[model samples]
Target: MNALSHKIIFFLFKLKLLQPSESTINFWLQSEDTDKLEYAVTQGNYKTRKLAAEALEQLAKPFSIPALLKCINDKVQNVSIACLNALERISTKDELIKTIVKKRFKWVNEIREKREKFEANKGKKYNIYRWERASKKSFDMVKERLKRPIR
Candidate 1:
């Protein structure tokens, strides 16, 4: 990796945002380095894993999608959120973004449907609790995202 790359990586590392060198990133993208890439995805520190996810999207490699998907369920919410945001950057790669959108839409729709069904079955009486609170929080996030100024 060049000095600039190292500096950037180090800065992000300090921020707990990324790990791995640029060349190491390229090496992970190479076919023969699949094992290393997979290991990096699983064993890398949060930043490294984040970088790996971004690299996979940049490389437009379909093989890395599964790993990226796994990141969506990561223990760290930041990692999972970053993985979702990276999916938007990778959306230009044919099925990549479409697949993620489809899955997320399905999940959101299922949640909405279930919520509606429950509300209907309950009939007239209204109670607010965990699931409703979570749903409201999710709606607020969506609203916030929608209201974001176009970059």
Candidate 2:
């Protein structure tokens, strides 16, 4: 599709005027033009990048994991947060652990620890209050960092 058409579709999708059918997502997942989706994830406007990450999460194909990983470094905090949230949902435990070991992403260790704890507690009900508290603390720290003046 042409650039204008792509923009219109993205706009409609963002506005909720166009709900992507499974086939549409599948098409993007399999098409050679997958680069377009990757480009949007990495280089599109903030809103577009957010939407693309969301779509990748919903599609949840393994191939999209790398793109999602890269998006974690987006300059925009919200875009990075969105990508992180999507990664949590779509990445396997092994992949998350691997990422934790390989990348210095914020909260990667916390995410790995929570995943390990969740696995250990499987088949038994467990309160995640501690995890929630830690996550909130991390988010607050990030917010504070963002507010500070850069050297």
Candidate 3:
């Protein structure tokens, strides 16, 4: 979009005349503007913020670290997870976030291992209960981390 159109949208958005839309997230993703993507991370709705976080992760811009760090505390579980994943990708120097990412990957790998061993090997009954419990446990652990700001 032209600069004038963007300015108009920002004006309307600031006046509370327009709700944040997924289209704006798409715009930021396509434009690859780190500042605008950061704004979306800070200001967009839950779903919009989630998409913006994923987009920033894909872009992997170093400057977006501060914005992603702030977004990791979003009230929405998915948004917080998305921000955490983005930080995992963008902040290589942060050992703590990297460790968290490793833990998350371990949980995922364990789930896949269980599925393969039970379902693929013996063709036995799928243990949906166990999978659900493990999934929830992992989710709650991540959610607990979301309750506080990441350093």
- Top model number, lDDT: 3
TM-score of each: 0.41, 0.45, 0.58
How would the candidate models be sorted by TM-score, starting from the highest?
Answer: 3, 2, 1
CA shift of 18, model 1, Å = 15
Q: Tens digits of per-residue lDDT for model 3 on 1-151?
A: 6656766775676676764566665676777877877877888778778888998999998888889878766777678778888988888997876886677656656866997787777855665654457888999999999999978
Q: In terms of lDDT, which candidate is stronger, 2 or 3? A: 3
List the candidate 1 regions with Cα displacement exceeding 4 Å: 1-23, 26-35, 89-151
Candidate 2 lDDT over 1-151, as tens digits, reads: 5446655765676665764443444456555345556656876678767766776766666677788888887887667777877777766666654565356454656666888998988889765664447888899999999999999
Better model by lDDT: candidate 1 vs candidate 2: 2
Q: After superposition, how far is residue 134 of candidate 1 from its true place, in Å?
A: 40
- The ten-residue window of minimal lDDT in model 3 covers 123-132
Cα lDDT tens digits for candidate 1, 29-146: 6534444455466667877676666666656555656666777767764555566665656565667567775686566568679988998888676665655578888999999999
Total clashing pairs in model 3: 0
RMSD of each: 18.4, 18.5, 19.2
